[model samples]
Target: MSIQAASNSEKPPQEDNYQPPSSLSSLPDDVVLNCLARVPRSDDLNISCVSKTLRSLVRSPELCRLRSRLPKKSLYLFYHFHQDSKRCHWITLRRGEKMITSTHDYQVEQRSCSLAGLLTSPHFPTFYSSGVSVGSEIYFPDHGWPFPSTKVRVLDTRSGTIRMVPSMKVARWAHKKAMGVVDGKIYVIGGTYGKNQVEVLDPETQTWEFAGEEKVQCNSRFSAPLEDKVYMVDLEHGRISAYSPREGINNVATERLIEHMNCMCVVENVIYACFKRSGLMWFDTKLKVWRRLIDSGGKATLCSFNAGKMAEYEGKLAVFWTQINTNFVEKVDIRCRIIALDRVGEEIRGKIESSGSVATCSYSITLSHCLVVSD
Candidate 1:
C-alpha cells in the first residue's frame, strides 16, 4: 500500500469541529507521530473515518519519516505441495496484505496471518531447500537435487508471487545456500557437478554467464556472501573459506567447525549457523573461532531448529521453523521469532523480541526457504 507523503513544512491540520480523544491527542506530537507510523496502511480508510485528527495524522509527513526509520522485516515462507513441482507457494509470516494470483506454472497465495503461515513442497527436503533473496527477488536454480538443470526461478516478495526466468547457460548443481548476490547481480556458487564454477545472472536482462572458476577445496552445498566476497565453510577440516570475485582471490580459510547445520546466513558481517539439534552459532572472523550464541541474559537459548530456515529481518535475526502438531490430525505449524542482537566487547548477544506460530496447516509440508524482504 502506498501513501502520498505530506509536506514537512505544513503541520497536520487540526480539527476545528470534531475533537479527538484526549488520551491520544494529549500526547506529544513526536510520540503521536510515531504511533501513527506504526498503524497499518490497510487501516487508513478506517482511521480517516474515525476522526479528523486521526486522518491528519495519517497524512502527516512526520508519519512517513518515522515509518521509514522503522525496520521493514517482511518475512516470506516458500513451500509447495509434496506432489507438485509445477508450482511454488510463498506465504508471508506476518499479518496484513492478502493476495492470491496464479502464473502459468506456479500458484501464488499470500496472506499475513496473525496465527501461522502455510507452505507445501514435494520437491524433496534434502536439496533445493532454501533460496537467497536479492532485494525484491529470490533466486533458486531449477536443480531439485538428485537432478540438475540449467533452469532458474525467481520469486517476488511484494505479493508472495513467483515465476521462472530464462534458464542459465550452464546447469548449477549446487544446493542450499549456493546462491548469493554481489553488486546487485545474482551469483551461484557451484557449477555443474560440484565444480568451483560460478554462474552470474543479470536480473535486468534475465541472462546468465559463467564466472572464472576458483580452486575451491570441495563442493560446498551452502555458501554465503560478505564484504563483497563469497564464503564456503568446510567444518570437517575446520576451515572457513572466503573467495573474492572483485579482487580475484581464492577463498581464505579460517578455523571453524559446523556439522548438521540446517542453514547459515550473514547478519551484520557475521555468519550465523543453525543446527537441527544444536540451537545457534556464529563464526567470529576476527578470532577465527566458532562460538555458541548467547541470549541477553548471558545464557544459551534453547531453540530446536528442526528443518528450520532463517534470514535477516528488520535489522534483526528472524528464525523460522516447522513442527508437527501432535494433538490434532496430521498438521504442521510454521513458527517465527524475531531476535534483537547486541554486541558487548567480544561477545554477541541475542534476545527474542517476539515468538509465535504464524500458520497451521492440515497437510504435511516441507519448508524450502524463509526470506526477509523490505517493504
Candidate 2:
C-alpha cells in the first residue's frame, strides 16, 4: 500500500474549498456584543483574548443585558489586600474611559484566602471589610480591634461560593461600617458595635438577626439603600437616620449636616453623600433637603476611599481602595485602583488621588460570583 500510501487512502474529501463567515455578514451577534461593550477597558481586555467570536463576546450575558440598557456602562475595579492570605484586583472601565483605562485594562484574579478561616476569633480579628452586591450575591461584614465577634459573609459573586453568618449582639467594629439591601434583607449599619449596632442578614435564611442598637454614637454616619429606605449618617453629630425593615424596629433620627461626612450612596432615589475631607451631599428623600453637590478638596485625603466598598457600576459610583502596608518589599508593588464615580459628573476632583496611609490595618474582601455564562 505504498504509492505515497495509496494516494492517502484515496483522498475522498474536497468541497471546492471553504466558505463560512456570513451570519448576515458583520454586526448582529447582539450588535457585535453592543459594539464590544463600547470597547475600551483596553480593548475589552484584548478582545477577550481574540477568537471564539471574541471569547463569546468577552464573556457575554447578552453583554450584561446590553450593559443594562446603557445609561453608561463598564466599571469593575475591586482590589483587596487586607491580607491574611487573600488578594484581589479587578478592572473594567468604559464610561468616557481613561485613567489610562485603569492602568491599561487591569485584571489580576487571585485566590488563596483565609482571613483566619474567616474568623471565629483569633481573639477578634478583621479591621476593614465591606461589600454588597446581592442578586448574584456579595455581602460582607467584619470590623476588628480587640472587638469583633460578629462576623458575616455571603459570596457567590458568580460562584467563588462561601456562606457564613451569625454575629449581631454587638462586639465592636466601626471604622466605617454600613451595608444595605432591604427586601431580601441585609441591613447592617453604624459599626463600632459596642453601642450602635443595627444588623440583619437573611441571604435566603442564613440568618443573623438583630435590628436595634443606636442610642447615639459617633460612627453612625453611613448607611444607604433607598426605595424601602435605609439611610443612616451622622457626620460626627449632625445626624441623618431612616430605617424601615418592613416597618418594625423603626428609626428616624435627624439633626441635619454641617459637613465632614465622607461616604454614602443610594443612587436613582438619591442620597449620595461624600464629604470626603469635606464637601458633597445630596439627601432629599422626598424633600428632607441637604443639597450641596460637589467639593471634595477642602483638605483632601479621603482615606483610600472605601465607602463600604461602594458599587453601582455601569451607572457610575464604583469604589475600591483599602490595602496599603507597603515596605515588606513594597508589599509586592502594591497596586489597587478602581474608582469610577461620575454618574452625572461632579466629584473626581484633583483627578485620581490616593497614595499612602495605613495604620494597623487588617483586611478581607471576597466577592466571588463568576459564571461568564454557560447554562
Candidate 3:
C-alpha cells in the first residue's frame, strides 16, 4: 500500500458541478422591463439593489412611462402628524385586500396596520393647507413662512421623488384656502384673511394665472374636484358653487347649509360631505339637493379623535382617523383605521379595510392632513 494520501489542495467533486442562481438579466430585455414595471412604486428603491441591470431600468424615465400604462392600480393614503415639530412625520397607508366574513359581510378592522413607507426628509415642507393629487403626483403649496419666497412642492408618489416647482405668481400660501385639480389644472381658491384671489396653475405649461375673483369665496374644507369643474360649498351663503375654467364660478342656490361640514370628497359625480354631528351627506348634482345617507356609526369614528379627512379610494369614499386608548400602563395606544364606503341608492355602507395601531406616551394623535394617490 503506497499510502497515496489525497493532496490537501484537491477540490471537492461537488464544487466542479455548482452553478450560480439565475438573475433578472438572464431574461429578455423586454421581459425584464415588463417585470420591473409591475413592481410597486414604493419598492423601486429596494428592487434597484438587486442588480446593475435592474438599477438602470428603475432610474430610466422610460420605465416610468411604461408603468403609467400598466392596468394595475394601487391606492395609497399619505398623512402627516405633529404640526409643531420642525420635522413632520409623513406616513403612508396602503389599501390592502378586504377580509370577507362568514356572513358575506366585509370587515375592515379599526386599528393601525403596517406602514407602506415613511417620509421625514427636511425637503418635505410643512403644509397647513390641503394638497391636491393629480394622477400620481401630489402638490403641496406651502405657506410662506421661515422663507419669504413662496413655492410649490411636488411629490411623485410613483417614483418617490420630490421637487420644487416654480413659485406661485401671487406668492401666497394656501392657508385656510381651497386647492383642487380640474381639467389638468390646479386651482388654489381663497387666500389669507381679506385676500379673495383664485389662482390656477397648468402643470403642462408650468405657469400660473388668476382664474377669476367672484363674490362667493370658496370654503376650503368643503371643496372637491368633480368632472370638468370644481364643486365647492359656500356654508355662509347656504349654497353650493361650481367653478368652471370656461364659464367662471357659478353658485347653485340651495337651502342646505353645509357650514358644519368637516370634510368632503367626490365619488361618481356625487359630492359626499361628512359632518361631525350629522354623519354622512351626499349632494346630488342632478337633483340639486343634499340628502342624508347613513347615520353616524363607524363613519363617525374617523372624526372622534380629530377632524377626519376623506379621499376617493378606488371609486369608493375612504375616511381616515385616529383613536386613542389609555388603559395600558404608561403607554397610550393610538389606533388608525381606514373606512371604505359603498353607494347603494341613498344608503352608503362602510367597511373597515385596514387597521393599525401604535403605542406612545402621548395621550392623543392629531391628524393634520390626509391625501389619496394612485400608484
TM-score of each: 0.70, 0.26, 0.62
Q: Give per-residue lDDT, candidate 3, residue 162.
A: 64
How well is each residue in 1-375 modelled by candidate 3, as lDDT tens digits? 233545433667777788998887998878888888876554577888888888888898888789778754334434333433333344454433343322112222222222223332322334345678777777877655543335677777766666677777665545555677987799877644455567889988888887875533555445688877877765356467777777877776467674476677877677877776766677767678766665236243323223366666555565654544556553444344445556666556565554555223344335445566656
Tens-digit lDDT track for model 1 on 1-375? 224445533545563355756887678878878887776555577877877887888888878788778756556776655655545555664433452221111122354211112112225223443366777777766544555566666666665555668877664454533566788787766544444456688888888776675533344555778888877765346356766666553546444454577777888888887875677878788766667788898877636466467777545677777777777788887766667778877888998766666667656566777776655
> Of the pair 2 and 3, which is ahead by lDDT?
3
Give residue 164's lDDT in candidate 1 (0 to 100).
69
- TM-score between model 3 and native: 0.62
Candidates 2 and 3: which is better by TM-score? 3
- Candidate 2 Cα outliers beyond 4 Å, as residue runs: 1-9, 12-30, 33-35, 41-94, 97-138, 144-148, 151-375
By TM-score, the best candidate is 1
